[model samples]
Target: MSRAEETADTAAAWIIRRENGDWSDEDQAALDAWLAASDGNKAAYWRLKHSWKEADRIGALGIAAVPTAPRKALARYGMPVALAASLVAAFWIGAIPFLSEPSAPKLVASTYKAGIGERKDVALADGSHVELNTRSVIRAASTSGHRDIWLDEGEAYFEVKHDPRRPFVVHAGARTVTVLGTKFSVRRDGGDVSVSVLEGRVRIDENPAKDGRPASTTTITGGMSAISEGRSTLVTQRSEERVESALAWRDGMLSFDRTTLADAAAEFNRYHRRPVIVTDPGAAGIRIGGTFQASNVEAFARLLRDAYGLHVEIAPDAIKISSQGVTAL
Candidate 1:
């Protein structure tokens, strides 16, 4: 089929989904992204919507020759005005009224940062709560129009209150997460950002460029994760156990489930000034699993030396691990 046809079909599907009475915040954000992608997309969506409404009106008058199920039913019994109102409400999910009062949204922005080995809990003006992990930085903003945050470093967990008038958004690395009300977390380590949803749903999209639109979009609900690096984002289903492990840092603990030695050390180093260096690729590949306090780097190193028989070298600023038979420091 042609590109225009495909766009119209997709828009029509969205309209139907909204009419099903279960349309969510994620769906509305998706609709906004679709509209912003291209002017052609907006035209196509409106074209199909107008045509659908016209067809229903003609069927109500028993004038259309269409034999479709909805059209046939409408021909036998006229469409109700209440149904038309409902259709209008459903299809207008993300649309702005042209004739409404012309006003701009008042934007409010603030920045918050946490130090190494320090955790901070923040309560916003909108009743939303944010917990910042060690060495994390975030900016929270709320206005009469919207609410959003920028995760500049490290990780944070959010417990957001329900407010359809204001969406809670997080900008991390190259991605943006939009939600109405949900329990979720966002972790940004350099160029990689991971988003985990614990309750409700959120829409993840590439950050729009200046005077440009988003590059990609996806929706993730509870027990789901979206990982973004560079220009790509991948969504995956996660077990409850894994989700809990991801959020365990809020409790001053780091939980690993069959995580690699290299990865486990990386988590440990996040909370401390000292770094962990893996010298042997073979030892780095060894999988270790357990729960440890975020500050218990010594115990973790001991476990690696005694249980795994890997060499451990300690320095004032860094710790080195290897598989070769070197004496443990």
Candidate 2:
């Protein structure tokens, strides 16, 4: 078989395995690495995945079905022979055409989002990388000479490819962050925005003035952060450890250093539909420190119960915590 055919088959195998209900983070990482290896691989995977979804819909509609063959005869890498045959047939029949080198690069508008308890990695057409945090959304668009991103909500870490001709700009809340090439994260909570730079530099410009006051611009480099609240923007230098802790969500963990129980609960709530609520002011004021799995609300609650001698009431809708002997409401 040709190299293209081999790649297509591998892509199909990946799609089937992903839908098998046991896909893990390691499997996702492997798939991401494969897709990032080449544009052809990424295109092939997306195209085939789209076709597979269409095939599923058609099957659900009771349409004429693709012929089934014995698994041993055509199965490749555990893929169902009928499905594999359908994919190949689709390519040949022009339902999903085989990809070829384009005459010119196409700039496609795309949106990347992650639901609660989920994270997503997006490889952009320009070689940049974006990792969306839980409950986050971002819209990305590119033109021949420019690239733009709007952080509609939540947070995302960006590894931008250096392109002098195409300025990469991210709009979040009332601020705009521009970078030629850099590694950074932008988070939006309502009208507030925060930017943390891990490498290189970025420029943050406040949006046009609405109160007849002049807007401001700030430039921050590696190990620095900028926060905007209302009309004020504050830039501060951060320790390397603090920077790493801030980005821990990308690794599915939450790192807290002397973080308050209330604040920690808020952080955990972003990844869980069921919230962790500290019932009393005393428990809310209690400071704790650790790195915990973001999705493991039960584990964190257990820690509060065991280590802090706190009362933990685990209901179907929420986890309530308070000082020992204090009933959680």
User: Residue 298: error of model 1 in Å?
Assistant: 0.5
Task: Quickly count the clashes in candidate 1.
Answer: 0
What is candidate 2's lDDT per residue for 75-102, written digit by digit as tens?
Answer: 6456565555665444323323345445
Worst 10 residues of 2 by lDDT: 65-74
The local distance difference test score of model 2 is 0.79
Clashes of each: 0, 0
Q: What lDDT does the true structure give each of the candidates?
A: 0.73, 0.79
Q: Single out the weakest 10-residue window by summed lDDT for candidate 1.
A: 66-75
Q: Can you give the lDDT of residue 207 in candidate 1?
A: 62
Stretches of candidate 2 exceeding 4 Å from the true structure: 1-108, 324-329
| Residue 148 C-alpha lDDT in model 1 | 76
